[model samples]
Target: MKSSRSITTILLVTLFLAFFLGSASAQEPVELQWLLIKFWPEYDDPSLLVIIDGELATPGSELRIPLPADAELNAVATAESSGRLLVNDWREETTADGKRILVFSPQFPVFRVEYYTPLAINGDQRIVDFELPAGYLSTNEANIEALLPPSSKDIELDPPADEQGPTQDEVHLFQRTVGEVKDQAIRQKITYVNASGALTVPETASSSGALLQPTPPPAEETQDKTATGITGNPWILLLGVAALLLIVGGAVGLWLTRETDENEALPAASPAPKIKRKKRSASTTIRASQSNLDRYCRNCGREFGPDDRYCRYCGAKRQTVP
Candidate 1:
């Protein structure tokens, strides 16, 4: 029972250490802001940006935009642009040391949206559609048409002081900690410094290009999809057999591996015993004549033990010496 308890204790300590090893954060707070193109109406219109941290919006970080009269408000989250944004889901994250990360979509580069379902905008019937690859800024950076395909302008793009972007791995992980924040415009400052020097360029609404429109993709000169031999392609039976064989081989390999691991993990055999040899030992001592109380009787050579005052053999006497 003691040994079993000891094992359990060791396992618990190991599991505890492992748990803390992967915890997302152990230090102080971190704040992150993601630019959302919330209400872009023009091609090069300035984008709306939001900085989200937990559930609390940073002070003085609301978006400054003029909402049009009768414009239906709808927000569609997508993943497309840069091929890293989420088509639907957006998320936020942290590291073991607690560094915060916000992910955006890469597929839905530009997600066009209306706030209220079956919504309309600018007297135009806005289509509530979903595509892929847009980042946190899709709705906030409303006038993204300037960066759209027809324009793919040679506009000089200088990365943020710390240049980061959405990747295909995923985006929007921050939402995990951010919780639910919808349609509320949180205020924040967009600080931009001048390139040449001295002059600080204030962040004004981007008013540049035209609102991007959807262009039908070019017609594909497709190879003959007309099945030359098999209509539904029954020759694929051979491919199916090959795939089955591969699966079987993989299963066998996995089974063998499990068996090998089980064998290896079995408790090691008990240790062999150690043999030992022994040898006899001896000792000696001396006493004074006055202290010879334990001496034998000299007359008969019989032993005079401590209990006897005189020798039992031949009646030899014993005298006290002080």
Candidate 2:
């Protein structure tokens, strides 16, 4: 009887486990997807940037990508490969080559920004995430999910877009991939999550379309209380400004001190302008040329004219000029 009871308990536990997994299986099956998207610079050839969701995709570093037997990625050089990838403020340009390409090369045209480094494949899906710098932008997920195939449902979008793309808004990333199913390969739409937290369908895009405006940056991260503006470290800047003020103040103080020293070293104030006694002399007597001044009348050619009086003969007078 005890043995029978143990067997019954085992059966009951098995039943519960099976029920949980069965319900999950009845729901939608989650499949891994591979795709590429394109983005244009805001003004000139904008920097190429990529940001993936932690649960959806990984930043592909070409170091080595694991392509499943049933999956294949091609012509990543084009902009349509990513659903969340789109043009920044600048126009788009892709130069195709039989053997060489410009958009993905490390030099010149290709400037890539990768987020969520070193990715790993989890089951079928590989998840990765990253943030665009304060001034950069990435694709919108709402438009991308509209182009994806079945087997997955895109959430967090207001509504989905038509295959061509959302008419109201432009698609940022183009997603295109070839996946395998039941021994046959198929070309299909790629889906992924974007910054807006939506599963999006991306179309295999071509640099072929007319260029559009660049996407604006996301809301700034103000978690830091000390940042003054978007561009600088406030503490470093404050220090520099304070240093400059101190330098200017020090120079002024030193100049004032020197002026005070010179003033103190100067001769005593001239003795209240002394009055000197004059040596009386006859009108004809001549004194040293440099010491004493002589008065002369221009009209009469008379010397030592009446003190402060004009010569009667010449009508010319010598006043006390001093």
Candidate 3:
């Protein structure tokens, strides 16, 4: 009986160990490629932009990131390869330890989170105490960049930056890089004195407008359709005018051809009347000769006898003197 009890206890322990190992293997943390944190005071209030670029072992999985309890979320988005930002849906949750976290299921691997937090300001000095919590993620690399105000002087950073220089935009920058960030939170403290209290960007340009929001991707199809609509109307109008002109020309041509055919199909006009000449009869000619008495002989210049039918001197026929 003692041997059987020992065997049973060993079997139970083995089973418990197998279950624990399986659970541990299933809850593996998501791996991040890089994390970029930027602190800028260009807006009406100081802001933080956190860009998380990572690949998910399982696509469409839930992701959670921890933030300060007092932080107010301004925007959350997923970035495309084309650098266009698409808005993402998220919700806020409170942890058991009284900390706040952002909860969302990301369909894509890369996402961005931005928020506004309180900046400690006293007189002409400003203070920023920023923290990045490692709730359930790990990263191979991390970068932090902070922009100082335009007229800031005597700038200071705790855990001093690795480099200090002016950025391409001519703004003073404090930069730091970390390797193999895992299972630990990152903290930074920056202080500066700005007697003028000027911001990195103008206040009017960043005040509760489009500057505060992420720019949406352009709608190429809609714009193409609008351009087609604008340009297509003139062509349609021109075609209509051309068709009308052709119709008018065809009608006129048909009318002119019909008129020519009608004139050709009619009979020719009648010719004018011609005058005829009358011929004299032989009896009329003999009466006119008998009435005339004065006569001359033919072939001789002599007087003719009465009722002579021939010329006596030359024996030639006498011509009538009619």
Query: Which candidate tops TM-score?
Result: 3
Arrange candidates by lDDT, descending: 3, 2, 1
List TM-score per model, in order: 0.21, 0.26, 0.53
lDDT of 3 at 6: 47
**Candidate 3, which segments miss by more than 4 Å at Cα?**
1-28, 42-59, 204-322
Ranking by TM-score: 3, 2, 1
- Alpha-carbon runs more than 4 Å astray in model 2: 1-106, 117-150, 154-238, 261-268, 271-322
Could you give me the TM-score of model 3 versus the true structure? 0.53
- Model 3 superposed RMSD (Cα): 34.3
Residues 197-247, model 3: lDDT tens digits = 666766544332452374332356643443344222334434454555555
lDDT of 2 by residue, 181-279 (tens): 222222222233333322233341322223322333323543222123322232344445455555555565566667777887899886686779895
Tell me which of candidates 1 and 3 scores higher on TM-score.
3
lDDT of each: 0.31, 0.31, 0.64
